[model samples]
Target: MSWMEDLLLLGIGGIAVSVYGVVAGLLLLGIDRKLVARMQARIGPPIRQPFVDVQKLFTKQNIVPEHAVAWLFNGAPVVALVSSLVILLYLPIGSIPPVLSGYGDLILIMYLLTIPALALVAGGFSSGSPYATVGAQREMVTMISYELPLAIVFIAIAWRMSADGIGDPFSLVTIMQYPLWGLVGPLGLIGGLILLFILLLVTPAELSRIPFDTPEAETELAGGLLVEYSGKNLAMFYTAQGVKTLVMASILIALFLPWNPSGLLGLGGILAAGIDIAFFLLKLVVVVFASVTLVRAMVARFRITQVVGMYWLFLGLMGIIALILLGIDAIGGA
Candidate 1:
């Protein structure tokens, strides 16, 4: 294709992926709510509750606090939503290579993963409320806490692949093509499992879901980072939250469970692609339920100090152990 044709295709694909991210994100959030309610033996909100909630938020007045940096407060939501959606463009969804596969890789995706949280921190600090400021600090702390284990997980996998002679080990396509599970021995399998567990634990914190939601503790902080937001601004944050959930789940799927139904079933053509996409959605729901909904429903919020301790000390040590095991496995294999 010519440069113009490639650009046109890219634009069209980008639009399609954006629309899918928004709709799927909201749908997954609704599903999460409904599932959590059922798990508690109560009638839940409809699966469309998120959509209704966003619509209602949009109808309300978007108030800018008199003490706030209005531009940063307002712009933060856009940044969060856009950055979360951009993650999808770089991730391989089911049988489809990432829309921008060649343009970026897993390293870029890791960096992108932090952008939404940073946006939340920006919004909170810019809001100028004491509660918002505290929340912003907690959000930054949470980001710092989880990043070590998260990076270790990525490095462990990529390093394992590189040891096995794969080029571009950090590439999402390369990682997907040679799943860590297939490349490892018995010890490496155990290490990979540990890394997967660490990543799964990181997911709730990364998305700021409960037990890990210190930044948005409604009871104490009164909505915390979002205390001052309302109307369209709040709506954007809500949508961004959903998108972030989807992005995190997608990342977990791409890393730990990159399997596709079509290949297993010996399917071909559009039908295979359709089945694979459906299967991918199923995987997303499962990951979200396990990492987000179930954890939120089962655990109470942790104190900020405890949150920091758990991630930085416990999870960080566990991630180091996993990486060490992988290193040993690589040496043994060699």
Candidate 2:
């Protein structure tokens, strides 16, 4: 394909993935509503309720706090939503590669992942509400706690990629396409699985889902970090959240499920794409259901202190073990 053709394909793919993100996000939320209701043995709203909720939020009146920094408060959701959209542009969807692969790297993508949280911090602090202030503190603590394990997890993956003879482990596409299972030893696989488990735990927290949702727990903090947002601003934040969840799932899929959608462009390619998408959605739903909703329903919310301890001690240990295993593998290969 010509450069122009590549750009067109890239644009089309990005748009399609964004649409998929919207659809998947809405679908997951609806499923969560129904599932939560069923888990509680209560009747839930209709499946279409998420769309209705977003519509209502958008049409609602804008409510800015008197003491708030107006510009920063207003800009928060825009930054969040735009960062999520940028992530989508960097992801490969099905048979399509990223629009700007030249600008993409796993490390870069990981850093970009922090933008939404930073946006939340700005929005929360600017609100000047007591609830928002408290939520902001919790958000910061959570970020600090989980980030260490997350960084170790990525480093372990990159190390495994290097061991595989994939030329620069930092290259997103290069590491992504390298067959992890083939390269890593048994111990490394075990460690990688543990690392993957930690990431799975962190994913919902990163996306502000339940259990790890102390920052926005409705019952505890009265909508918590988002108490001050309203109207289009709130809608923008909500949409950004939906996009973030999709982007997280896509990253997981890319890193772990890259083998599917085999590169042969024909019926085989179509079959590969279909199967890959099905498995991708299946895995995503399973993660959402098990880690997010199920855990939320089963366990009471953790106090901020407990959450901090949980990530730093338990998850951090797991990540270190994974890194050690990766290092051992590299030594053994050498």
- Give lDDT for model 2: 0.79
**Model 1: per-residue Cα lDDT over 1-334, one tens digit each:** 5999989988998998998999999999999999999999999999999999999999999999999999999999999999999999998878988889899988888899999999999999999999999999999999999998999999989999999889999998988888889889999999999998999999999988899999999998999999999999999999999988889898889888999989889999999989989999999999999999999999899999999899889989999899999999999998
Look at candidate 1 and give me any clashing residue pairs. Answer: none
- Regions more than 4 Å wrong, model 1: none
Question: Could you tell me which 10 consecutive residues in candidate 2 have the lowest summed lDDT?
Answer: 258-267
lDDT of 1: 0.93
Looking at model 2, the pairs that clash are none
lDDT of 2 by residue, 1-334 (tens): 5989977977887777677777777777777778888898989978788778888988899999999999999999999888888887777765456667867777888889889898998999999999998998889888888888778877888877876667877765775667566677888788778877887788878877777888988898888789999998988888788778778777776766565545543346567778666766776676667656676778777788888898999999888888888789778866
TM accuracy, model 2: 0.90
Highest TM-score against the true fold, candidate: 1
lDDT of each: 0.93, 0.79
